[model samples]
Target chain A: MKTTELESYLAERRQLVQEALARNLPPPDTYPPVVHQAMHYSLFAGGKRLRPILVLAAGEAVGSQPEPLLPAACAVEFIHTYSLIHDDLPAMDNDDYRRGRPTCHKVYGEAIALLAGDALLTLAFEVLSRIPATIPPERILRATRELAASAGSQGLIGGQVVDMEAEGQPVTLEKVNYIHNHKTGSLIRACLRLGGILGGAGEEQLALLTRYGEALGLAFQITDDILDITGDFSQTGKQGGVDAARGKATYPACLGVEASRQKAGELCAEAGALARALGPAAEPLELLAGFVLRRQG
Target chain B: MKTTELESYLAERRQLVQEALARNLPPPDTYPPVVHQAMHYSLFAGGKRLRPILVLAAGEAVGSQPEPLLPAACAVEFIHTYSLIHDDLPAMDNDDYRRGRPTCHKVYGEAIALLAGDALLTLAFEVLSRIPATIPPERILRATRELAASAGSQGLIGGQVVDMEAEGQPVTLEKVNYIHNHKTGSLIRACLRLGGILGGAGEEQLALLTRYGEALGLAFQITDDILDITGDFSQTGKQGGVDAARGKATYPACLGVEASRQKAGELCAEAGALARALGPAAEPLELLAGFVLRRQG
Candidate 1:
C-alpha cells in the first residue's frame, strides 16, 4: 500500500475505533461526572488509536470483519489509555502533557485522575466480557485472558517497573530489550494475538501473528525512544530531551540515533515479511509496520 | 450451624483462598522482584478475608463445592487487595500504614505501589479468565463481567470518587448510604452474584443472594465505621479515629453511634432472613451475617 493509501486506511479505521469508544464509554456528563469527564478528557485527547487499529487489522488478516471485532478493539484502547493516564501521574513519569494537551492528573486532580485510570482499566474487562454475543463466550474468555496477561505484572506494568527502576542506572541492550518488550511490546503483541484469537485463527496463524507482533512492537518502541531525543515537542506531543534530562535509558542513549534507526528499520522489515506470510489479507499489517517505522510521534 | 461450626467453616474457607492466592500470584522472587514483593507484602498482611469467604459461602449456598470456586474466590480478594494498595497511595489516601504495617507505598515508594496495584487488578482478570476448565466458559465469562462491573466506574470506583469528593464537606445520610452502597456494597454484592452464577443457581436463589449481599455489605461497612470510632488499634489494625481525622463521611457520623448500631443490626437481620430463605445450604451465610453485626473489627 502507498503512503497515502495507508494513511487513508488508518484514518478510516481510527474513525471506526473512535465511534466504538464513544459508544462504549460512559458519557462525560454521566453521574459523578468529574471522573467520567476526566476519563473523556484523556481518552479523547488526540490519541492515534494505534492499539485498537491493530486489533481490527489483525482480525481482518484472520478473515474476520471489523464490526464484530469493535468491542475487542475498544477494549485494547481502554487499557492503553489507562496505562497512559497512570504513567503520567506525578509519582510515575510526572508529565504535564500527553498528545499535546495537559495530562489527566494535571486537568483533573490526582485523586480523580487515579480513580479515572482505575475505572478505565476495570472498564476494559467489562467491555471485553460484553463483546457482541456474536463472538463465542469461549473466545471472549481467551481474549480477556490474553489481554490481562499482557497488561499485568509480567507484561506492561512489569516493563514500567523495570524502566522506572533502570533510570539513572547503567544501560545495557539486554535491559533495554526487557523493558521495551514488557512495557510497550507486551500489549502491542497482545493486540494482534487478541484479534487472531477472537477472529478464530488457527494455531499456525496465531503463531505467525505473534511473530509479526513481537517485531512490530519492538520496532515501534525503538522509534519511540529515538523520537524522544530527536523529535520536537510539536511532533512528539512531549518535551524533547526529557528522557535525557532524567538520565533515562533509551535506544538512542544505548545504541546511538543512527544505530537505533537502522535497528528499527530491520525490525519493521522483519515484521512486514511475517505479515506477508499470513497471505494477502495481511497487506495492511505490512503497511502498518512501515508506518510505525516512519511515524514522527 | 453453631457459632463454632461457622468459625471452623470460615477458617477452612479462608485457608483455601490464601492457598489459592499464594499458588496463583507470581512469587516475590519473580523477575522484577520489587513490584512482586510489594504485591505480596500487602496481599499477605492479615485481614479478614471477607470478600473471598463470601464467594465461597455463597457458592456453597447453591450447592457448589469450594474447590471449584477457588479461582473466583481468590479473584475477589485480589481486587480487594489492589484497591487497598491504591487507596493507600500518597496520591489517594496517603496512609503510612495498613493492617499494622507500613503501607505498600511507604515500603516500596509511590511508583511501585501504584504499579503493584495495577498488576494485581490485571491479575484478577487473568485469574478469572483462567478459572478451571470445570466451570463452563460461558459461566466464566459471566463471572468476569460481574466482577468488572462491580469494580468499575459505576460501582466501586464511583463510590470512591464520590467519597473522596465528599470528604471534609457537609455530611448527609443519603450521601453516606450512597458511598457505603457503592464503595463497599458493590463488590460485596458482586461476590455473592459471582458465586451464584458460577454455581449454577436458579434465578430465585440468585435473587436471595443479591439481597443478602446488599444487606450484609451495608451492615459490614456500618460496623466498620463504628469500629473506627470506638475500637482500639489492636482490633482494627490501624490508627483509631482516623476517619474523623480526615473528616470522612460515615454511617455513624451521619446517624450517630446508637442509630448506626441499630441500623447495622437491622441490616444483618434482613441479610440473615434472606440467607435463611436459601435453605439448609445457606446456614453458613445466615450465621455469617450475625457475625458481621457483632464483630468488633
Candidate 2:
C-alpha cells in the first residue's frame, strides 16, 4: 500500500471507530451525567485510533471483514483510553494537557475523572462480551481472557508499576524492555492477536501476526520516545522533552537518539517482513509498520 | 437452617473463597511486585466474604454444585476489593483504614494503590471468563456481561458518582435510594443473579433471587448506616459516627433513625419471604437476610 492509500485507510477506519465509539458510549444525558460526560470528553478527544485500527487491520489480514470486529476494536480503544486517563492523574503522571487540551481531571474533578476511567474499563469488557452475531462464544471468551491479561498487572498496569519504580533510577536494557513490553506492548499485541483470533486465523497465521505485533509495538514505542525528545511540539500536542525532564526511562534515554532511531527502523523492517510473509492480505500491516516508524507525532 | 448451621455454612464458604483468592492472586514475587502486593494486601485484609457467599448460596438454591461457581464468586470479591481500594484513594473518600488495617493507598502510596485497584478489576473479568471446564461458554459470557454492566457507569460507578455529588448537600430520600441501589445494590444483585444464571435457573427462580438481593442489599446498607451511628467503634472496625461527621447521605440521614430501622426490618422481611419462595434450598439466603438486619456491626 502506498502512503496516500494508507492515510486514506486510516482516515476511513478512524471515522468508523469514532462513530461506533460514540454510538456505543453511554449518552451524556444518562443519570449521573458527569461521569458519562467525562468519559465522553476523554474518549472523543482526538486520537489516532491506532489500536482499534490494528484490530481491524489484523482481522482483514486474516481474510475477515472488519465490520464484525468493530466491537473488539472499540474495546481495545476503550482500554487504551482508560490507561491514558489513569496515567495522567495527579497521583500518576500529573499532566495538565492531553491532545493539546486540559486533561479529564482538569475539566472534571478528580473523583469523577477517576470513576470515568473505571467505567470505561468496565465498559470495555461489557462491549467485548456483546459482540454482534456470528462470532462464536468461545472466541469471545478467548479474546476476553487475552484482553484481561493484557490490561492486568502482568501486562499494561504491570509495565506502569515498573516504569514508576524505575523513574529517576539508572536505566538497564532489560528493565526498559520489561516496562515497554508490558506497559505499552501487551495491549498493542493483544489488539492484533484479538483481530486474528476473531478472524479464525490458524496457529501459524496467529504466530506470524504476534511477531508482527511485537516488532510493531517496539517500533511504535521507540518512535514515541524519539518524538518526546525531538518532534515538533505543536504536532505532538505534548510538551517536547518531558520524558527527560521527569527522568523517565525511555529508549532514547538508554540508547542515544540515533541508535534508538536505528533500532526502530530495524523493528519496522522486521514487522514488515512478518506481515509480508502472511501474503497479500497483510498489506495493511506492512504499511502500518512503516507508518509507525515514520510517524511525526 | 438454624443460625448455627448458617454460621457453619458461612464459615466454610468464606474459607473456600479465601483459599481460592490467595491461590489465584498474582504473588508478590511477580515482576512489578508492588501492584500485585497491594492488591493482595487489600484483598486479604479480612472482610466477611458476603458477595462470594451470596453467589455460592444462590447457586446452591438452584441445585448447582458450588465448585464450578468458585471463579465467579472470586471475581465478585475481586471487584468488591478493587472498589474499596479505589474508594479509599486520597482522590476519592481518602479513607485511612479498612477492615481494621490501613487502606491500600495509605500502605502502598497513591499510584500503586490506584494501579492495584485497576489490576484487580481487570483480573475480575479475566477470572470470570476462566470458569471451570464444565460450564457452557455462553453462560460464562452472559455472566460476564452482567458483571460488567453492574460495575460500569450506569451501575456501581454511576451510584458512586451520584453519591459523591450528593455529598455535603441536603439529599432527598429518592436520591439516597438511587445512590445506595446503584453503588452497592447493583453488584449485590449481580452476585445472586450470576449464581442463578450459573445454576441454570429458570426465569421465576432468577426473579425471586433478584428481589431477595435488592431487599437484602438495601437492608444491608441501612444496617451499615445504623452501625456507623450507634455501634461500638472497635467492634465495627471503624470510627463510629463518621458518616454524620462527613455529612454523607445515608438511609438514616434521609429517613431518621427510627424510620430507617423500621425500613430495614421491612426489607429483611421482604427478602426473607422471597428467599423462602425459592424453596428449601434457599434457607441460607433467608438466614442471610435476617442476619443482615440484626447484626450489631
Candidate 3:
C-alpha cells in the first residue's frame, strides 16, 4: 500500500475508534460531571488511538469486520487512556502535558484526577462486559479475560511497578527490556491477541498475530524512546530530555541512540515478516509496523 | 439463628474469606515488592469481611456452598480495599489512619498507593474472569457484568465522585442518599446479587436478594454515619466526628440524629422482611440484617 493510503487507513480507523469511544463513555452531563469531564478530557485529548486501531486491524486480518470489534477496541483505549492519566499524576511521572494538552491532573485537581483514572479502569471492564450478544459468548468471555489479565499486575501494572523501581538506578538492558516489554508491550500484544480472539482466528493465526504484536510493540517503544531524545518539543508535546533528567531507563539510555534506532528497525522488519505470513489481509498490520518504524512522535 | 450461633457463624465465615483473600493475592515477594506489599497491607487490614461474608451467606441462602463463590467473594474485597486506598489519598479524604493503622498512602507514599489501588481494581476483573469452569460460563459472564457495573462510573465510583464533590457543601438528603446508595450501597447490593447469581438463582430469587441487599446496605451506611458521631474512637478504629469536621455529608448531617437512627431501624426491618420472604433458606441473611441493626460500632 502507498504511504498516503496507509495514512488514510490509519486516520479512518482512528476516527472510527474515537467515535465508538465517545459513544461508549458516560455522557458528561451525567451527575458528578467533573469525573465524566475529567475522563473525557483525557480520553479525547488527541491520542493516536494506536491500540484500538491495532485491535481493529488485527480483527480485520483475521477475516472479521471492524464493527463487531468496536467494544474490544474501545476497551483497550479506555485502559490505555487510564494508564496515561495515572502515569501523568504528580506522584507518578509528574508530567504537565500529554498529547499536546494539559494532563488530567493538571486540569482537574489530584483527587478528581485519581478518581477519573479509577473510573476509566472500571469502565473498561464495563465496556467489555456489555459487548453485544451477537458475538459468541465464549469469545466475549475469552476477550474479557485477556484484556483484564493484560492490564493487571502480571502485565501492565507489573511492568509499571518494575519501571518505577528501576528509575534513577543504573540502567541495564535486561531491566529496561523488562520494563518496556511489560509496560508498553503487554497491552499492545493484548490488543492484537484480543482482535484475533474476537475474530475467531485459529491457533496458527493467533500465534502469528501474537508474534507480530510483540515485535510491533517493541518497535513502537524503541521509537518512542528515540523521539523523546530527538523529536521537536512541539511535536513530542512534552519537554524533551525529561526522561534523562529523571534518570528514567530508556532504550537509547541503555543501548545508545545508534543501537536503539537499529533495534527499532529490526523489530519493525520482524513484525512485517509476521504480518506477511498472514497474507494479504494483514496489509494494515504490515503498514502499521512500518508506520511505527517511521513515526517521529 | 441464635445470637451466639450467628456470632460464631460470622466469625467463621470472616476467617474463611480472609484466608481465601490471602491465597488469592499475589505474594508480596513478587518483583517490585513495594506495590504488592502496599496492596497486601491495605487488604489484610482488619476489614469486617462483611461483604464477602454476605456473598457466602447469600449463596448459602440459595442452596450453594460458599466454595464455588470464593473468587467472587475475594474480588469484591479487592475492590473494597482499592476504594479505601484511593479514598485515603492526600488529595481525597487525606486520612492518615484507617482500621486503626496508617492508610495505604500514609505508609507507602502516594504513588505506590495509587498504583496499588489500580492493581487491585484490575485484579478484581481478572479474578472474576477466571472463575472456575465449574460455574457456567454464562453465569460467570452475567456476574462479571454485574460486578463491573457495580464498580464503574454509574455505581461505586459515581457515588464516590458525587460524595467527594459534596464535601463542605450544604448538605441535602437527596444528594447524600445518591452518594450513599451509589457509593456504598452498590457494592453491598452486588455482593448479595452475585451470591444469587453464582447459586443459579431464578429471576424471583435474584430480585428478592437484590431488594434485601439494597436495604441491608442502606442500614449499614446509616449505622456507620451514626457511629461516626456517637461511637468511641477506639471502637470505630478512627476518630469520631471526623465526618462532621470534614463537612462530609452523612445521614445524620441531613437527617437529625434521632431520625437517622430510626431510619436505620426501619431499613433493617425492611431487609429482614425481604430475607424472610426468601424462607428459612435465608435465615443467615435475616440474622445478619438484625446483626447490622444491633451492632455498636
Query: TM-scores of all models?
Result: 0.99, 0.99, 0.98
Q: Candidate 3: which stretches are off by over 4 Å?
A: none
Model 2 misplacement above 4 A: none
Give the alpha carbon lDDT tens digit for every residue of A34-98 in model 1.
99999999899888999999999999999999988998999889999999999999999999988
Clashing pairs in 3: none
Q: What CAPRI grade goes to candidate 2? A: high
- Winning model by DockQ: 2
Residue B185 error, candidate 1, Å = 0.5
Q: What do the candidate models score in CA lDDT, each in turn?
A: 0.93, 0.92, 0.90
Ranking by DockQ: 2, 1, 3
Give the DockQ (2 decimals) of all models: 0.87, 0.93, 0.73
Compared with the true structure, what per-residue lDDT tens digits does model 3 show for residues B120-144? 9998988888777788878888888
Using lDDT as the yardstick, the better of models 2 and 3 is 2
For candidate 1, the per-residue lDDT at B156 reads 93
Docking class of 3: medium
B1-297 per-residue lDDT for model 2 (tens digits)? 799999999999999888888877888878787888898899988788999999999999999988899999999999999998999898898889876789999889999999999999999999999998699899999999999999999999999998888889996999989989998999999999999999889999999999999999888889999999999866777778788888898998988999999999999999999999999999999999988988885
DockQ of 2: 0.93
